[model samples]
Target: MSDIEDKKNSLIEKMGSEIITLAHGSGGKAMQKLIDQVILGFFGQPNQGPLEDQAIFDLSAYPNHSIALTTDSYVVTPLQFPGSSIGHLAVNGTVNDISVSGAIPLYLTCGLILEEGLLFKELIEVIADMAEAAEQAKVKIVTGDTKVVDRGSCDKLFINTAGVGVVNNSLNIRIPNIEVGDKVIINGDIGDHGVAILAARGELDLQTTITSDCQPLNGLIQTLLAEGIPIKAMRDVTRGGLATVLNEYAQGVNLGVLIQEAQIPMKTEVRGVCEVLGLDPLYLANEGKLAAVVPAEYADKAVEIMSKHPAGQNSCIVAEIVEDHAGRVVMQSDFGGKRVVDMLVGEQLPRIC
Candidate 1:
C-alpha cells in the first residue's frame, strides 16, 4: 500500500466517533474507509477481492446461471425533480447497480418512508412513476413496505430498493478483470441529474432547460452484453459521479486511469450550473449514466454498441487504463496538463441520489 493509504488507515483507526457525518454517506473516500474499518472489519478479515456493486452467487444446480443482487436508497430532496421522481430514481438506481454487474434484473422490492404530512396525491404520483419506470426496465416490483413517521421526523419521502437479477454463467466480468490498455466508455452525459436536481430546488434562482438524466439502464446494458464486447467491468456513476467511479476502478485494479477532459461527455447546461455554483461536474452525481471498462480492441465496438440504445446515444470513449501511477485517476486537460482526480472530500450536493 502507498504511504497515503497507510496514513488514511491509521487515521481511521485513531479517530473516535460514534456519530456519522454527511461525508460518511457521500459514497466517497471517507465513506469507503468507514465501511472498511467499521462495517466490513467487524465481520472479520474481509474478502481480499475486487469490490463490485453487486454481490454475485453461484447456483450449482443451474450450471448456466448465477444471481446478482444489489440495493440502493434514494433521498434526493424535492422528491419530484425535473425528469424523475424519488420513486423512479429508486427503481432505476437499484436496477442499474445490478445491471452494471452483467446481470439481467428480474425483480425489485421497495421500502418507502413517508413523512406524516406528505400529500397522498404526491405519494400516488411517485408510485405511479415507479410503476412506469419498472415497466420500462422490464423488471417487476415483486414486494414492498411502507411506513409513516411524524411530520418532522423525516423528509417528505425516502425510497429504498433491493434488486435481484440473473447473471449469465458465461460472464465473468469483475474489477480485477480491468487491466492496462483497457479503454473506459461512458454511456451518455455526466452531471445532468445532479445539476437538474439542484436547479429544481430553486435555491440559486438559476434558469435552464436541463433535466435529470434519470432512466433505467438495464435494456441498454443488455444490448451491450448481447454484443459480447469483452467488457471487463461496469459502473453506474451515481452518488459520486464519473470521478468516483473511475477512482474506484483504479483502486480496485491497482492501476492508473487517464481520462481526457475534452472527451468527457457533459451538457452545457450542467457545466453552466456547476460554474455558477462553484461545483465540479466530475464530483457531481448522475443517475442514468454508466461507465464501462473493456479491452482496447473492443473499445470502439463498446461505444458503438451503447450508442445504438436510446439511453446510451451520447456514449463516448472517455479514458484508458495505464500501468503508471497505480491506484490513481489522472485527468488530462485541453492545455496538455494533467492532475489527479481524487474522490470528494466531503458531501457535494447532499441528498443527491
Candidate 2:
C-alpha cells in the first residue's frame, strides 16, 4: 500500500475505540479519518477526486419540464435497523414526497449532522446504505454537507435531503380534484415503519421479525400514472399513518370518509405489537406505503396496476369518500361497530423519520 494508505490505516488502528470522539469533529486528522473512512468511502465522487461545496445540474436537457422541489429531515435513532438506515430513510422520504406530487425524482442534496461518540462503523454503514437506496430510486445525490457536533448535542446522526423532480403537467393530480364517491386505496401494510423503530429501541423488550417498510414509492406511483389511472389525491402513509391522511383529505374537501377495518391491510406481527401495546395501528406511521383517492370506477384498475409491482403487491381499497358527515373520518370495525378515526393528539413514535 502507499505511504498515505498505510498512515490512514495506522490512524484507525491507533484510535483504540470504534466510537467517535471530539477530535473527529475538530477539523483535524481525526476528522479527516472520519470523512475518509465513513462518508467519502461510501459515496465517492464520480468525475472528480474530491467533493465540492455545490453541485450543478443542466436542466436544459429536458425542454419544457416542470420541476418539483422538496426537502425532508430524518432523525431515526438506531441509525442502522432491521431493514433500513437513517440515510436510506432520508433519500426515500424525499423522493416519495416529490413522487406523490406527480413528479419523477431526478436529483438530491444531502446534509448530515453527526454526534461525537458515535461509532465510525455505523456511520459508514449508513452512508453506504443510502447510496444503494438512491441508486434503486434512480436518483443521484449530486451534492451534500456534513457537520459533527459534541456528544449529546445531537442524536447519533441525522440526515436532511432536498430533492428535485420533473413533473408531467398533463396529469395535474391534486387534492382539490377529489370528488364525492371517490375510493381510497393504500399501497401496502401500515404501521411497519413505526413499529420497526419502536422495536429497534428495545424499550418494550419485544421480539418479532417485523422490519421497517421504508422504501421508495415513486416507481409504484409511476406505474399507476403510466397505466392512465385517474388519481384525485395521493398521500404517503408516514408520520400519522392512514388515519391522519384520511383526516387530511376529508377536512380538505369538507367531506366525510368511511373506512372498513376488515379491508385495511396490516402485517400480522404489526397488529400483534399494537394489540400488546394498546396502540391503535391506524394512527401509527408507515414509510414505504401510500394512500390514494381515485375515482370509484378506476379504484379496481388502480389496485390492479399497483399489485403488478412488487412494492405495491398488497394494495387494497380501504375507504370511500362520502358527503353526509362532512369533514370527519369514521371507521367500521369488523364486529360491526363504528368509531371516529380522529387525528392523533401527539406523535405515536418520535424520530421515526
Best by lDDT: 2
Candidate 1, residue 186: Cα displacement in angstroms equals: 0.1
How well does each candidate superpose onto the true structure, as a TM-score?
0.82, 0.92
**Candidate 1 Cα outliers beyond 4 Å, as residue runs:** 1-63
**Model 2, span 60-132: residue lDDT tens:** 8667669999999888888877788787899999999999987899999988888887876566567767878
Error of 1 at 24 (Å): 33
Off by over 4 Å in 2: 1-19, 26-33
lDDT tens string, model 1, 4-51? 234435544455323334444456885576555533332212353765
Residue 53, model 2: lDDT of: 79
Q: Give the TM-score of candidate 1.
A: 0.82
The count of backbone overlaps in candidate 1 is 0
Candidate whose TM-score is highest:
2
- Lowest summed-lDDT stretch of 10 residues in model 1? 39-48
